[model samples]
Target: MEPMIWRQAEQALAGLLAARFTKDIIRKAEERMRADVHGTLPRWISAWQRLPQTGSLDLEATRQTSAVVVSNAEPIDLEPLTRLLMEFHPWRKGPFEIFGTRIDTEWRSDWKWNRMAEKLEFRGKKILDVGCGNGYYGWKMLAEGADFVLGCDPFLLYVMQFEVFRKYAPQPHRHFVLPLGDTDLPDRMQCFDLCLSMGVLYHRSGPIDHLQKMHGTLKPGGQLLLETLVIESDQPAVLVPKGRYAKMRNVWFIPSVAMLEIWLERTGFEDIRILDVSTTTEEEQRRTPWMTFESLADFLDPQDPRKTVEGYPAPRRAMLLAVARK
Candidate 1:
């Protein structure tokens, strides 16, 4: 059998097995990688393989620009590179600049990052990002001085999308996106300094169990940075969607900030702090050239923007910071 395309990633992961992760953790990660059954795996791998390689590319995440920028001292052809990148279409989570080609993704994720950047500290912290779409936030965290970031999302396309950037990354091993979900993580491993669950809570059928899993992943006193869909309500309340919310079938629960805090408190997290609560606007998440599919605009009701097509409350999100109890 031919060697797997992600053999290098596995090797890089192996280097961390003894120092940072348990053997079981590494085993599960590798197993996930090896057990690829996605129909688009071959095409995504081909697109990733065809990406242009460069030497000593500069990777920068500047305050001046929202896009994760990658530039080479020597110029490269933008046309072919842009075409190659477009193979992994529906780019959902990034606004990246590779060489001179700009990939304007579906969500302006930088806006979400900026909301909480000033309040949080990432220096020297090891982070685990659940539902880390294409590892965009991982790079942003690293730029803010995170020591290491391990991202997991069950979506195979997002994992392959990360591979495209990983190819040209100056330090590829600093961040890795495994094709695993929160449920795949070993219980009570307690290895990371921080755990991030962004845009994932509502999709979970059991939100409290998801929070508890995140709490268990962190070391004693480690932090949990959670960002999820929330409704505007003063009291503890939740919206259990009858069918679909915002055109998403997996969205099971949309809780108010009060209810979210209660979930954290009940899941062994302390010092709960609400960082940011903002209404998700079309400008923040809309269709772009790189991602042409239906977006926030399509999900909202045409006559009443405040409600979804299904007559539920429109999308609102909140960022919360909490410390895992020792």
Candidate 2:
């Protein structure tokens, strides 16, 4: 073969090897996640779909009387999420443990789900956490005496992450990544007392599809816990350059609380209630935008009065929490 051709062939083989290695690593990570979760909650765990799911709560239904019911996906063994933190964040060494056994660390301090937890009564009731990132809220529900708590997300990486953390901070009856939708949920669906979804809708390609899917999962009288980012002013929602959701460009920023209320009604979620409305702090502004990697910073200092030139403006950092019943 010609030398040039041989060199090109070598380059192609190297690229293939790199891709294969990355894929294998991801696969191993997933297997590790499944193994940890199944190891901890073997009796309570079971996959609803063919895919491997993860979380700490038992998803089996237990005579739920709410409008929505929770169920488990298939069971598997996986590693603890805490171990990953230790491996990745060894620089900040400590006895690193879960902040609240009731809630995982990610959703606890900043998001303030504990405030909402005050109004919710999950004892002996079934709860479904849609888009249950790291299974934190589901852990909270289970800790609060929920009969069954299921945490569902479509992302494999998230399910894996949930499984990893679950071992160190085990909760009862929370299943993860069991892809629930209208058709699958309707079949053999159990009713639930309450359902929760947070920090999820914005990432969706079709938020309405997910909402409808959750509606099918609910029983005739179950409550839905909902939260998302919203636009406060009447002006159009802008897509920040290099924003995380900007890649998909499917994020719809509702300008008013009334708009969200109307959409819920249209989707057959009645008794719609706006639970809380709050603006982002300057620090939050910096961190969230930094997550997008959009700018250098939100401001020079967290307390800076000016929205940082390098960070997302405060107006673009609004969040909303609401609830309704089907």
Candidate 3:
């Protein structure tokens, strides 16, 4: 079938990867996607392939933040569409509405967008969003007049979500969510106009490497918007959580804003400016029907909300922008 994932990612990457291991990358990605089917993934893909596309779809990625609304679809049945969407459960970072059916996600990603859009200017910029969940922010970036947005996330479900958006969206070539992580992407030294690493830094054991790689991906004088979890700490100003923070076992390092700035400077990002910092609230991340897992509410200490159930500081995130000094 001409490698479905390649067809999905090719036009978006276009010239970037055409002569540079595109075939090998596709081969590996194909292997990964088709490997050991133990759960709902196979069924999800089958259903997605068989699902009907709506007629004369009207698409909007800007009118509503974290949403690529497909409206004016009298031809598509809302219930069937909703059922198909539910197959890809746990929509984390979007509030997409297909036809009239609303998929309110776990995170009110619009809040994150609002915080970012105020500082971001994407005109004629080819941008990269690492750890981009469902490519929600990429749609917003395009809405802000970006030339193109390439999103990278290893998770297949998010890639599927992007495909869902693509089926309804015209000119989806402008935005793509590739099924690749930080290690997977080839470093095209000094290529992107801007690079964003939001909500991803702390996930890496070697956070400095993540920052350096982000810097490597940016062209000279390119901008980087880095948003990640932070902690209010004392001397060290960085916390290595014992087990879990906000019920996420994957979190490794949560640095104070000062510590993060130092890390950025060490990683060779200049003119670093802290834009925003806010503690994650229940309203921001809670169990929605779309993402049924226990969220921030279930993670925080019941008697004292500021402390996590593990008794560590609650989740707080910071947004910082810098120019790559490379």
Candidate 4:
């Protein structure tokens, strides 16, 4: 069989990203796709090949709905379809409905989109989404009238999950999720109209450097929507967890909202606004059938919901909007 990985993404990037960056990005992505040694890849690929093709579904209807719903005019057997989708388990970032089967993901990512969608406009904009899990928000952005969306996530499983959707969507070329992260992006490309770095900052050891890289990728006056875990403090304070916070081993710096603003300013971003800061709730993130792994509820102290099992303040996230200053 012909290569199924990164083929459409490579084609889409040819027209979307700058020529200076396109070749290098595609080259590296292709290399990663080829070098995969994961044992589950073959099983995932087999499952992808068996998915029933729905010819020309109404893509417009998805724009008005919350879920990425794809339906055929005629009913098809859902039992096998659901099982095929289950092959790529642990859906982290969406609540997608393929045919009639609802894949209730770990995160109610739609809730996050609803919070930020009113403040922003996506009409005809070129967007770059860093750490885009399963490209869930990319579809939401497309629904909001984005010209094109290029998303990158280092996790190959998320990339495969995206492929499941891309396999059935009518216009697959408009959105893509490459198996790469922010660091893999070309240097000083300065091409996108909007850059999104949501739920990714605290994972980076150098949060400031990550912000600077995001700043460099956008055109002058381009907008950036950054969301990350923040500690509540009147003063500029940050928690550098000596060990796991909320049962997550990768978390590094959980800064105050005030400190996050300073990081954006120092990284050449202006018009900084803290759009929303909300504590994560079990209703928003929990163990679901689609995602059977431990969730936010498991990470918190059963005795005290306010504190994590490690005694740090529980996961409180903040959304910030700013513009790249040349």
lDDT of candidates 1 onward, in order = 0.84, 0.44, 0.80, 0.86
Native-vs-model 2 lDDT?
0.44
Evaluated against the true structure, the overall lDDT of model 4 is 0.86
Query: Model 2, 89-166: lDDT tens per residue?
Result: 211101113321111121122244444766667888767777665455565565567766656565444454454444
Best by TM-score: 4
Return the TM-score for candidate 2, rounded to 2 decimals.
0.55
Please report the TM-score between candidate 4 and the true structure: 0.96
Model 4 ranges off by over 4 Å: 1-7, 55-58
Ranking the candidates on TM-score from highest down gives 4, 1, 3, 2
lDDT of 1 at 132: 98
Q: How do the residues 90-135 of candidate 1 rate in per-residue lDDT, one tens digit apiece?
A: 8999788888788999999999989878889998988899999999
Clashing pairs in 1: none
Q: Which wins on lDDT, candidate 1 or candidate 4?
A: 4
Q: Candidate 1 at 159: error in angstroms?
A: 0.5
Which of the two, 1 or 3, has more TM-score?
1
Sliding window of 10 residues with minimal summed lDDT for model 4: 53-62
